[model samples]
Structure formats: C-alpha cells, structure tokens
Target: MMRRQFFLLPLMINALMACLAMALTNITTDQHALLAFKSQLKLDPSHILSKNWSVSFPTGKWIGVTCSPRHQRVSALDVSGMRLSGNLPSQLGNLSFLASLNLSSNSFHGQLPKELAQLHRLRYLDFRLNGLTGDIPFWLGLLVELRFLNLRNNSFTGTIPSSITNMSKLQVLDLSNNPLQGNIPEAVGSLFNFYP
Candidate 1:
C-alpha cells in the first residue's frame, strides 16, 4: 500500500499541474484579447482602458470588467460612455465566456466583426449610439442565448435579417434610428418575448 500511494502521488501532482496550466491559459487568452482591443482604439479620452488594462493587474479587477467567480474568466465588459473611439476588433470574439458587452455612446465605427458570432454565451449586447456602419450581420442569429440586443442610433443599412428569428430567447431588440428599409420578418412573430 505504501508503494502504491507513492506512485499515485506523482500522478496526482501531474494532474494538478495540468489543471493549473489550463486555468492560466484560459485567463491569458482573455487578457490577450482585451489588450488587442485596446491597441486598436483611436481615442481614449480619459485613459480609462489605457491605464487600467495592463498585464500587471488582474483583469477582473480592472475598471468595467467583470469575471465569473467560478471560472475567473471575463464574463462582462461595460465600457459605455467613456468616449472611446475605434473599430471593433475581431479579438473580442476570444472572450469565450463573455455574456454581456455594452459599448454604447462611444465613437466606434466600422462594421460588426463576424468573429463575434462565436460568442454563443452572449446574453446581453448593446452597441447603441455609435458610428457603426454596414448591414447587421446575420451571424448574430447564431447567438441563440442572447436575451437583449440594443443597436439603436447607428448607421447600419439594409433590411433586418430574417435569421434573427432564431433568437427565441431574445426579449428586447432595439434597432431604431437606422436607415434600414423593408418590413420586419414575419417569422419574428413567433418570438413571444421580442419587443422590437
């Protein structure tokens, strides 16, 4: 029994090391993605993210960042109304655990990054009051778990995609103040929670 226990100790230690490595890697991915986003910003009027987002600090402790207690991964990022101006970076899609993202009342422009479709865990997304252009990507429908989506007061054109009907869980969808034409999709009537 002593010999068996001795051999098991090494195996247990190796397993613990592997778990720790995985946990670090997960948080590192979130850090790298956020840094990439900050690098692309054209303006940070108050240097909120400029100074706060650094390798020296834990991401969860950063201003406007929220991490899940169980996973220690970034789960929510609300940088609304900081006067930030930039193109949305594709690296944001790397925040695999992100559930709520609010970038409203900023100066961000450019089209929505298609990579964002990877955020299957997203529940609340608000991009209102920006200069974002281009058609709302149909891939947004892939976020089946999304509950609230606010894209009001943008420059997005084209008709609302019928694919949005896939978001059965969606409760609030505000697409007001755009230049979009065409009627709302008939299939959207099935979503009882949708308020348009």
Candidate 2:
C-alpha cells in the first residue's frame, strides 16, 4: 500500500498543478477580455473604470465587475450612470459567464452590439437612459435565462421584436419612452410578470 501511494503521489501533485494553472489561465482570459472591453469606451470623464480595471492583477474586485465563486470568471458588470459615451463593444461577449450587465444611464449610442447575443447565461440586463438607436435585435430572444429586461429610455426605433416573447423567464420588460412603433406583440402579455 505504501509503495502504491508513493507512486501515485507525483501524479496527484501534477494534476493539482495542472488545475491551478488552468485556474490562472481562466483568470487571465477574463482579464484580457475585460481590458479589451475597457478599450471600447470612447469616454470616461471620471475615469471610474478606465483606471480601475487594471492588467496588473486579476479583476474580480474591480469597481463594477464581479466574478463567480467557483471559477472566478467575470459574471457581472454594473457601471450604470457613468456617463460613458460610445458603442458597446463586441469583445464584451467574451464574458461567457456574465449573468448581469448594467450600463444604464450612459451615452452609448448606435445599435446594440450583435455579439452580445452570445451571452446565453444573461439573467438581468439594463440599458435605460442611453442614446442607442436602431431596432431591438430579435436575437435577444436567444437569452432564455433573462429575468429582468430594461430598455426604458433609449432612442431605439422599429417595432419591439416579437421574438422577445421567447424569454419566458423574463419578469420585467420595460421599453418605455423610445421611438418604437407598431403594436405590442400579442404574446408579450403572456409573460406572467410583465408590466406595461
């Protein structure tokens, strides 16, 4: 028994080291993705995130960022009301574990980044009070885990995509005060917690 234990010891240690290396790699991937996201902001008057989300270390403790307990992957980003003005970056979709993202009350304009549809785990999303234009992407329906959806005060045009009805888990749907026209989809009323 002792001989077998000794033989397995090095293998176990190697496996442990591999796990640690993978964990470090996961952190580094998130850090690199976040730094790419930081590069997208065209404006940051107070420098809230511009300086805080640093490359020198892991970023879970950064001001508006959060990480999962198990994998330490970035899972939330809330920088609402920061007054950042720019388009949402496609690199943000690299945060595959993100569950909540709130960039509300900023000045981000142009259409929502199509790449954001990759965040299948997203549960809460808020873009209230932005300068965003273009149609609400029908692709948003792919986020079946969404619980709270808020786009209350943007400049989005065109009709609300009927596909949004696919978010059966959605509780709050706010599209108020936009340039959107056309009838509210008949299915929208079926959301049990939907507010008009």
- Against the reference, the lDDT scores of all candidates come to 0.94, 0.89
- In angstroms, how far off is 21's CA in candidate 2? 5.8
Candidate 1 structure quality by residue, lDDT tens digits, 51-115: 99999999998999999999999999999999999999999999999999999999999999999
Per-residue lDDT tens digits of candidate 2, residues 1-196? 9999999999999999999998788777778777876788899999988778887556877989999998679999999988888878787887889999999999999988888999999999999999999999999999999999999899999998999999999988899999999999999999875666
Per-residue error (Å), model 1, residue 27? 0.5
Q: TM-score of each candidate? A: 0.93, 0.87
> Which numbered prediction scores highest in lDDT against the true structure?
1
